[model samples]
Target: MVVQTESFVMLSIVLFVLGAMGVLLRRNAIMVFMSIELMLNAANLALVAFARYWGNETGQLFVFFVITVAAAEVAVGLALIVAIFRSKRSINIDELHEMKG
Candidate 1:
């Protein structure tokens, strides 16, 4: 059975909203990072759905680039989080804001 693009888009929207809420409501750095990744995945899902619906490769190609950038972001972001956790012994966002040099 062929899946409709609207369904995919709807699911993507739900995921994006959940990610946004997570980002806004979570105080843990790792949780916030995960939420950002979730948002990215949601966007990628929509892009792939649109690409499939339109019979074009452009959206899919864009999604590929986005995924690549997201990977790099994950690497760098995790490294920073680790470093901060090592120095501060905590990963709380509110505490992190107090780290102004």
Candidate 2:
């Protein structure tokens, strides 16, 4: 059981790293946002796994908080994305640079 839990955590960590890499390397805004969500989900998975392995409820509570925050973030982010799309007609991260000034 311990070995299985450890392997699950390792896999989740690898997936989180890949998602981080995708967020860093992708130029598309939507893809980057999706990658960020993927990373969050991966962490949630790890937390739940650890909670089950250790027989603790704290990890589950933490996962709940994470999910709440992720939901709020996605809502606000998508709204902003829509506004940007309406103004610029493009979802590319590079195009957003012009808005800095």
Candidate 3:
């Protein structure tokens, strides 16, 4: 069973758009961070689809690097979120901006 590249690309686009909406519409810092991760995953999906269609290993290799970076991003992002929540007792972005010095 062969899947078409267009299908994967379309799914990626939909996921990316949903992620963008989540980032824009949600006021919670954690939600925005999750949406950003979703966007990254969508891009990774597109990259893998293109690599498979082109019969090349480059995109797959690039995905490994992306995943590595994403892992680091997750660690740092979650740590920040935890710290913010501890200090503010809230993860609302609007409330965070009031902390401007």
Candidate 4:
């Protein structure tokens, strides 16, 4: 059985909304980062679906670039989070008020 394009888009939207809510509601740095990743993945899903629907590779190509950037972001972001946790002994966003390092 074939899936509908609208259904795919709706699912993608649902995932993106959930991720956005997670980012807005969660206070932990790691949680916020994960939520952002989820949102990015949701966008990728929509892009793939639309690419398939339109019979083109442009969206897919964009997804590849997104994935690459996401990979780099994950590496750099986790490092920063780890460093912050090491120095501050916490990962809560509201607690991180100091900028001088």
- Write model 2 residue lDDT over 1-101, tens digit each, in one string: 64678887998999899899989999988899999999998998899999999999999999999999999999999999999999999889987675555
Listing every candidate in turn, what is its Cα RMSD in Å to the true structure after a full C-alpha superposition?
A: 2.0, 1.8, 2.0, 2.6
Q: In terms of TM-score, which candidate is strongest?
A: 1
Rank the candidate models, highest lDDT first.
1, 4, 3, 2
1-101 per-residue lDDT for model 4 (tens digits): 19988898999999999999999999999999999999999999999999999999999999999999999999999999999999999999989877856
Candidate 3 local lDDT, 1-101, one digit each (tens)? 29999999999999999999999999988899999999989999999999999999999998898899999999999999899889989889888666566
Q: lDDT scores for all predictions?
A: 0.95, 0.92, 0.92, 0.95
Scanning candidate 4 in windows of ten residues, the lowest lDDT window is 92-101
Model 2, clash count? 0
Candidate 4, lDDT over the whole model: 0.95
Using Cα atoms with residue i matched to residue i, what is each candidate's TM-score against the true structure? Answer: 0.92, 0.89, 0.90, 0.91
Clashing pairs in 2: none
Stretches of candidate 2 off by over 4 Å are 99-101
Candidate with better lDDT, 1 vs 2: 1
Tell me how far the alpha carbon of residue 13 in candidate 4 is from the true structure, in angstroms, after superposition: 0.5
**Candidate 1: which stretches are off by over 4 Å?**
99-101
